[model samples]
Target chain A: MKNNFRNSKLLVIEDNSDHRFFIEKAMKTCLSEVSAIHMSTEQQAIAYMDSCLYQEWDLPTLILLDLYLPNRENGWRILEHIRQMPTPINQIPIVMLSYSNQRDDIAEAYQKGISSYLVKPTHEEEWVSYFQKLRSYWWETVTLPKMRFSF
Target chain B: MKNNFRNSKLLVIEDNSDHRFFIEKAMKTCLSEVSAIHMSTEQQAIAYMDSCLYQEWDLPTLILLDLYLPNRENGWRILEHIRQMPTPINQIPIVMLSYSNQRDDIAEAYQKGISSYLVKPTHEEEWVSYFQKLRSYWWETVTLPKMRFSF
Candidate 1:
């Protein structure tokens, strides 16, 4: 598949450092020219989004969010907040990447408006394959919303 | 990837007969055992959904929606109506597949809460590739919410 995500910027809100690193690395490998903004906490992510709104910064093409945060149930809250925002900001696709495979958690995330839910793989090889498939589908096949910088 | 979607059903809302056939064919080719329900208009889709609800029939795992419909601007309306429905029904992932690649259309669909927006490709080879990628990503890699029959 062609690198359709060469110029895309992605926002990843993952608390685990190792996971964040792997995701960033995988995304970079998947897309020739990609800029990924990583956030380890809910507050940081909110602050970044707020700043982007206030400063008219270009919004990320996609958001990869972790379900379980370090010390709070903030993933769902964050998703709800984004969905409640005005216009284009609310339109950004949020894909939940979590270890929880419980039906309740999956149902709850979809109910909260996650674009898709992916179960985090335990094996490193599985992670690689998962990200590769993700890159192929989302970046190559899906037509992501064009982020307009003008407000 | 294992056939996680063996017993799953898919709801396809498209006005064109050719598109519906192709989608159904592609999905069947991708998944070993998949039942796809096709509707040509918004009214039909709504009636089908209502019947499924009333009859306690199994809801679809995914919805492939067309942006333009016959005689009305019903795509967004249908999406909004589904989202307003009670819990599990509203949680069904709606993927918008349209020929229109307009930024406004894409942005509007996402704002209306479509899980993903894919531009309907004209070429047969492209459609095959798209459906293959879609099946791999959604059916195999992603965790779909379990459809609960009981309200």
Candidate 2:
């Protein structure tokens, strides 16, 4: 059998250029072959997601959502929009990656139904370690639904 | 500050007593300190969850659901039930453990919003490794919403 994740793509929604640079760097180091799309704002994310619905596009295998685009509320807004998308699109696992460890933010993220919440690391090396664990779980250990279907 | 998971509890809902035994054994070997509650039937699972609402019961930090109580449809039934429960109760991450790897089953499990899908290992040693990866992701690396809230 061939590798199931040969074409897996990760969609990252993060606005901070610094964080975005680190995310791509980490993915390149940890899971080099997994292509990623970084949308720096809520509007870009919505437009790209909407475009996927209309055009022949390969929907992302997983989503990494940054909890704030200057405001945490925007995180909730984009998450709601994605969750409300049709069928398997909504089913795509959205792991929230945020710098905030505030109880209210974590609690509310769960209340609104994020697949998992990860506290963003501070240093570049720590970011690599973070993605290593992320890769170990999502890529190596668990079976992802995205590998099996497309429309 | 105290360890957040000081009082964390795991809820395992499996109809097979044999599988139940293995799961418990794995938890002890890997995460001995975390208390576990195992329910052997769908009714028991529902009763336990419902009772938590009225009593001073501790809500499970994580739920491990057996794909079938002899039939796969039962997994969906119980999952939908739990997903509809009130507030943070519905927010608890439910990891579906199953022997079936049918594309349809995996796809539908995601469609229904399972936190993740794991394939049940056939050997005792493999089960431990499975739980090890599980522990690595869910326990050590990621920040679960469960550790932070209560009704």
Candidate 3:
């Protein structure tokens, strides 16, 4: 895939250090022009989103969301807020990248209007290949709505 | 995947005999419980759908729609009619499976609310694998809206 054609950014929200490192390492070979921003806490993610809104920055094209968080609000709440946001922020494609295998979680996420739900692959190669295909389709093939809000 | 689940049907509307055979063969390995119904002409497909409605039978779970059909009305017109249908047929997932590589076709199909757009892979093995994944995700894994009315 042509790297220049898809320069969309990705945000990864996870609390685990090992998982963060694994994602970073695996993404190197899988996707082209992917820049991932990570946060260890749900508060941090909310704060980051707040800052982005204040600064009027373009939202990431895709978000890899984890269901669990450090404290207080969880990923589902965050997703709900994002979906309810005005204008461009509401249009960003958010995919649940969680280890939770519960059918209810999957069902609930889809019901809440999640773009996609993927169980975190166990192996590094599997993770890489999965994200590669995901990036290729979401960024290159899919006509994603713009995510920059204007007053 | 367990093959004991409620069997979902697939109606593939395609004009090419080879392509129909290819899809049927591929679907057999991946979707054992799925009953695939294929039609080479628009008249036959419409007739089948109408007959299902007339007999008060449940419609197919999903449709692998081909854009080019041998009839007066094109695929889009059929799709529009399906969307306008009164009962269970209105809610069926219609994933467009087409050979058209044109960007306009892709854009228009999605704009018309296609569940998914899949390009026909050139390689046989790749086609099989791709269709397997499609079957798993779209047919077996995803829980579609319940059929409200038969026909």
Candidate 4:
């Protein structure tokens, strides 16, 4: 049976303008009906989340997080804060998008309850395909609990 | 840069003959060149694993496991035994495949270090699609360290 829902919405937390633009272009080119909210700073991401809560919009289904950012604290700290949030928001899947594939990075992400750890690809086509495959599999196939279904 | 390896070898640890046959057929149809092995008993599975070690073949990329089996003990007990084994085989990814979607079941599976918890789908297509997508995303697209690579 064909899935009725459009591709899942995503929140991308990355500091680099070029990388963010590339990812947005890739998603638009590959996945269907996926909208992304990109934030360059941790403060901006937190502000957007607060606004989402205030406006009562459903939180994004997946978060693509870059471990390194222009901000002082970095992405893991943001993930920690989001995980501490009361409900509805805490359940969103956060996948780490990082350049480092160090064992420590993988171990720490798993320890912090990140859904998945991915090493960013060097090639543009590979990167695009990564998100395309992610969309096709995770958003289209997996039966994740909707925001309304969350506590 | 498309991934060269598009399929994964999977081991399904379950005792029910009907369910095993259903899953086997599903994998054969939905997956491309996937090697699927089904073991009905823990003793048989462990025995097969021992034989595989002598053959110098790599461990299956993912394990789909049922929590309950015909054996007197639970699957978690078998998982505990696997975790204690030395390197090489100890690192295989185990995905808990079960009909139980209870919160406690999910929590316990994660606690015991299951790679993922999949609630067995009622429909055949959904079941086929679930395993196919998992193989595509986790095994094909993601970078899983070989047993020899883990430090």
Candidate 5:
């Protein structure tokens, strides 16, 4: 499984510290060689992407972004910030995270070019199971873009 | 599981007769309520999208497109065609299917705005496993856009 995800990376942009820690740990449980970069704010997330571009290091293969707004229209602003980037950076797959199951929210995310919409789980165990399913589907079944090292 | 995929739909665009049949069967094995629309040519695929728009029936939630060209340059033309469409239609997730594991192929697909790239498995059993993982990841974990009834 490690060989399958060779050169692959993940970027998680969430404001909540507990969620940021919980997500990173859950992902590690599913994939042994996990090393996810965490960004607590939208600004930090954007800066990380820019740093990747400027440093010549490869971008993360997947991005998990949390919806930030109190109202229904969450994640769009941050998604737009990332989408406004240049070239391949803008093309990276982003999975938008939210706490709602409303059709309108999913519809809006789809319209905004979000790769996938994920509802935050209620319990911690569900997070592990979620990452396991994600591991099998995304890491094993899917072919991701090539990654290059800075060195 | 049936309720999870309530109004969701799938479009499979593959030239090979066996693979098209195989993918549909494999998907059905995992998801009890499976109804996949198959198209043999790029034109047929495009027409289906147009028909969905004209009829006001929502488009498929996911699309599995085969890489046609013998060289690495495949699936881009069909991808471009779909992307040229307006609104949510163009933003629908399209997974590129191929038999190659080359990084270049995956990179190109990502660059072309493909949601994901999947390498077609060799054995028949692998196909079933692939669909099962797909079911778990896409159907259960991901919150797909709401589907509409034509009537």
Candidate 6:
């Protein structure tokens, strides 16, 4: 696959340290230019988003969120918070990266307006291919909303 | 990429005949087994979904919707109608395919709960690659929600 995702920012909210490291490594290896920001807790993620709004910072191109988090609100709550944001801020794509393949979780995520739901792969090779295909689809095939930052 | 999409159904609601043909052809070419059902009007799409509910028929794995349709309700209206459906049906992924790259359109589509927004490629090669990447991402990398048909 071609690398069309250069210079794109990806914000990931994952509680597990190993999963976070794997995702960051896979994304950086797969995309030509990727700035993957990690937040281990829901509070941190929300705080980061608030700071972005306050500073008028450019929002990440995509958000990789874990369904279950430790010591804070879960991914569903985060999804709701983002969706309630005004205008373009609410339009950013959010893909849920969780281990839960439960029917209720999948249904709820879609209903909550997730861009996509992906079950994390178990093996290392699978993760590599997963990130590769994801980058190809989002960067090459999809037309993301043009982010408008109010000056 | 693995052909995990065998026997999967895709409902396409597009007004333009040429675009429909291209999408169907591309999907068929990329996936090992794909049933691409085309609906030119919004009414037909609704009718199909209703039939699936009434007859306990297998719903499509993904819905390819056009933002602007020739007759009846547009894509946004259709999206709203689907999202209001009960349970699993509402969970079906809806991807908007449009020639319009307007910021308003993209933002509105995402806000209304589209899974992804894709700009229709102008060239044939681009369409082929687009479908290939989309199939790889959705069928291989992502775990789609299990459809529940109430008899």
Report the number of the highest-DockQ candidate.
1
Instruction: Tell me the spans in candidate 2 whose CA falls farther than 4 Å from its real position.
Output: A1-4, A55-57, A147-151, B1-4, B146-151
For model 3, state the Cα shift of residue A61 in Å.
Answer: 1.1
Q: Which stretches of candidate 3 lie over 4 Å from their true place?
A: A1-5, A54-57, A70-73, A147-151, B1-151
Off by over 4 Å in 5: A1-4, A69-74, B69-74
Complex DockQ, candidate 4: 0.23
Q: What tens digits encode model 3's per-residue C-alpha lDDT throughout A1-151?
A: 2232344678788887877877887777776577788877777877777676766544576777888775324887888877676555655666777777665675566545565667777776666666665755665444454334421
B-chain TM-score for every candidate: 0.90, 0.90, 0.87, 0.83, 0.86, 0.90
Return the interface RMSD of the candidates, in order shown, one decimal each: 0.7, 1.4, 5.5, 4.3, 1.8, 1.1
Residue A96 miss distance in model 1 (angstroms): 0.3
TM-score of chain A of each: 0.89, 0.92, 0.86, 0.88, 0.85, 0.90
Looking at model 5, what is the TM-score of chain A?
0.85
Candidate 4 stretches greater than 4 Å from native: A1-7, A70-73, A149-151, B1-15, B26-129, B145-151
Question: What docking tier does model 3 reach?
Answer: incorrect
**Residue B16 displacement (Å), model 6:** 0.8
- Which predicted model would earn the best TM-score? 1
The positional error of residue B6 in candidate 2, measured at the CA in angstroms, is: 1.6
TM-score evaluated only on chain B, model 2: 0.90
Which portions of model 1 show Cα errors greater than 4 Å? A1-6, B1-3, B149-151
Each prediction's Cα lDDT score?
0.80, 0.80, 0.66, 0.68, 0.74, 0.79
The deviation in Å at residue A39 for candidate 1 is: 0.3
- Please give the clash total of every predicted structure, in order: 0, 0, 0, 0, 0, 0
Q: How would you encode candidate 3's per-residue C-alpha lDDT over B32-125 as one tens digit per residue?
A: 7778888777677777777777654346777778887853248887777776666556656677777775656755665454655667777777
For each candidate, report its DockQ versus the true two-chain complex. 0.89, 0.67, 0.12, 0.23, 0.68, 0.79
lDDT ranking from best candidate downward: 1, 2, 6, 5, 4, 3
What is candidate 3's CA lDDT for residue B73? Answer: 47
- Candidate 3 chain A weakest ten by summed lDDT: A142-151
Model 4's alpha-carbon lDDT is: 0.68
TM-score of each: 0.92, 0.91, 0.58, 0.68, 0.87, 0.92
